[model samples]
Target: MGHDTVETPNLSFGRGRTPGRSTPYAQYARLDELHSLQHPRSKEPAELSFIVTTQVMELLFDLIRHEWTIARQALREDDLPTALAALRRGTHAQDVLVESWDLLGTMTPQEFNSFRSLFGEASGFQSAAFLHLEFLLGNKNAALLTMYDGMPDTQDGLVEALRSPGLYDEALALLARRGLELSPAHSEQRYRPSEEAAQAWRRVYTEPEFAALQPLGEALLDVAERVTRWRQRHLSAVKRTMGGKPGSGGSSGLTWLRKSAEQDVFPELWTIRNEL
Candidate 1:
């Protein structure tokens, strides 16, 4: 007693369209556009590996930044579980980022030289996304903004990130709110370890009543450890591929990386351990 109803598919573009144009996956991911972006300046096949690896790392950097932003906001709201979940996700992304160096770890000096000239003054150090990550991690260095002088939008974003409270700052504020005494962190300045922060974290590790806060401390330490590993891997990769050369983008290369590798992410997180 009912009439059959059927939905008609849209056929204005025709059914024989290429997969790149018609597939839902391709349209959502913009596969065709992504594939079109690679234009290798050098004919050397190894260059493709370099380009792809760099691009993948850049994407991962943004992804990690996204996770951290979520985690930071959650921490501000005292949502420990959400913050921890986001940090765990960010650490997983960090693991992928660390492993990504394997794609370039074995490149011989000869292979690198083939395309090194093409990079002329361009360097991974100039990545705005990575800089955003650094700022979120409390490594606020305003001088680096000069690098983006030609990119007003990027520089503006960096300025805002630089001025905003970093992940650790939010965590510290949460600790203070929870009755732990700590000095207020100035988001625009580079982070320094405070004895007050050290004492607060020490309580988190040692006091039975503060056991709930231990996981937050551990999560932060996990993030810090992964960041250190990323830096170490980067240093090792550069040393293996091009020993002691001045870096692209006017960086000191090995010297700069060595210093960076020595610097701790979330300094108080590690320093507190000695007291614990």
Candidate 2:
């Protein structure tokens, strides 16, 4: 049979005579429930854009975290190609996340202010999914997990992630398996750049025998750079809309975000470049 002439099955939906019968896409996606989530506090036209943008960012955060988890698991299994593929997908998702601000970028300060007061104690800092993404990227901090204490299920998930092996941990483990000496404490604690870690990567970059690690290192750096760009863009967005005002959840606003941007994830990956 010619390719274009191949017959495809058209199964009947069997959604009896109801005028508003649900389609398979809607049933699988729960799109009606998803659309119902955007209950803006005010009738201001800009509020819908603001709400939808925030929701989209949240979904992207989850997407990135999911990819990171897959990469971390692949590394644990010594599957470098799978891990690198997943990390590359994560970078693309982060790129979308960075551009998501453009939606809100269209709103003026007055438009944001119209609905800002309605946000109450809510803030991006309260985003469990973003925190999960950070945790998978090895930005562990038990103190920050306290924010979710009010929600036991969320707090438990954060606690589990806090103790679980992170992406950096898996990377270090892979290096160790390849005969490099490393302390388990490196994974047990929040990741910090160390001389040994840098030398390990230097070997990967410099020695032909370990060239395989180079792509993984570069993939991780890609993720790190995208995250930094996101932080910078987020800071700019906040400054443009809110000025120096305190963030909704008692955060120090721009000062806090700028400091966060300074703390680079995958620190040793960047430092090793100087040696190369």
Per-candidate clashes come to 0, 0
In order, what lDDT does every prediction score? 0.90, 0.86
Clashes of 2: 0
Instruction: Report the lDDT tens digits of candidate 2 across residue range 11-34.
Output: 344323255666688779976578
Candidate 1: lDDT of 60? 98
Q: Which segments of candidate 2 are over 4 A away from where they belong?
A: 1-20, 184-189
Residue 74 lDDT (model 1): 97
RMSD of each: 4.4, 5.2
Q: Give the TM-score (vs. native) of candidate 2.
A: 0.90
